[model samples]
Target: MSIWWSLHLRRDAASVPLARRLLLGTMETAGVDPDVSYDLSVALSEACANAVEHGGDTPDGPSEAYRVTAYLDGEKCRIEVTDSGPGFPATRDRPSIRPARTDAEHGRGLCLIQELADHVHIGNKPGRGGAVVSFDKILKWREDAPLMAV
Candidate 1:
């Protein structure tokens, strides 16, 4: 069975939980294991929060939006979050994920997403003016769950 969904949301704080709840509901309906679903939800939340906080045009310009897409196929799931802010720093400018200093209050979203997802890809949107963070995970279903429809 395969299912997919996409959301175009304003780059606002409220949109974060909206995306998370929808993902959670979809995973639950598909009988994904609770632990897997929880991990994915946390990763999704981090991605969305990043978009809301950093993925936008200049503050004086028009409000911008972000995109979230999720695909569920059999025992695998993939999710992508795209934001309209300045794309991620150039490849050479990105630093490896590391534990933030104890006094730091930020810089952990990407690291958290990386830890939670099995595979992650971050880069600019091809030919577009935004950044994209994509990830996938192998899903585990409940033993008694019914087969999901494609």
Candidate 2:
């Protein structure tokens, strides 16, 4: 069985948890292992939080909203978070995961997401002008758990 979902959310802090909770519920229903689900949830939170923080308008006016998409196919789950902000510096200028400074209280979101997900891809959204953070993990389910009815 395959399951997929997408959310178009405003660039607001509250929207972060909304996305996390929905992803958790979906993973739970699909019988995903708790540890795996937790990892994915944390990664999802980081991605969504980044979108909420950096995926917003320029000085002129508010930009378009952000989007999150999740797809579970066979034993793999993939998630993507795309924002409508100006996007990170040019691809060549950005590092895969920049280490946060010792005294810094922020700038760890991308690094955390990379650590949690089995595979991660980050870049700007094509033509639209924004950033995209995508990740995938091979899922493992509880042995005794049954798949949810579609």
User: What does candidate 2's lDDT look like per residue over 1-150, in tens digits?
Assistant: 789999999888899899999999998988999999999999999999988888888555776578999998888889999988888888565546887998999999988988989999888867867888999998898875577333
Candidate 2 displacement at residue 126 in angstroms: 1.2
Error of 1 at 67 (Å): 0.5
TM-score of 1: 0.90
Cα lDDT of candidate 2 equals 0.87
Which candidate number has the best TM-score?
2
Of candidate 2, the 10-residue stretch with the lowest lDDT total is: 141-150
Name the runs in model 1 displaced over 4 angstroms: 58-63, 92-95, 148-150
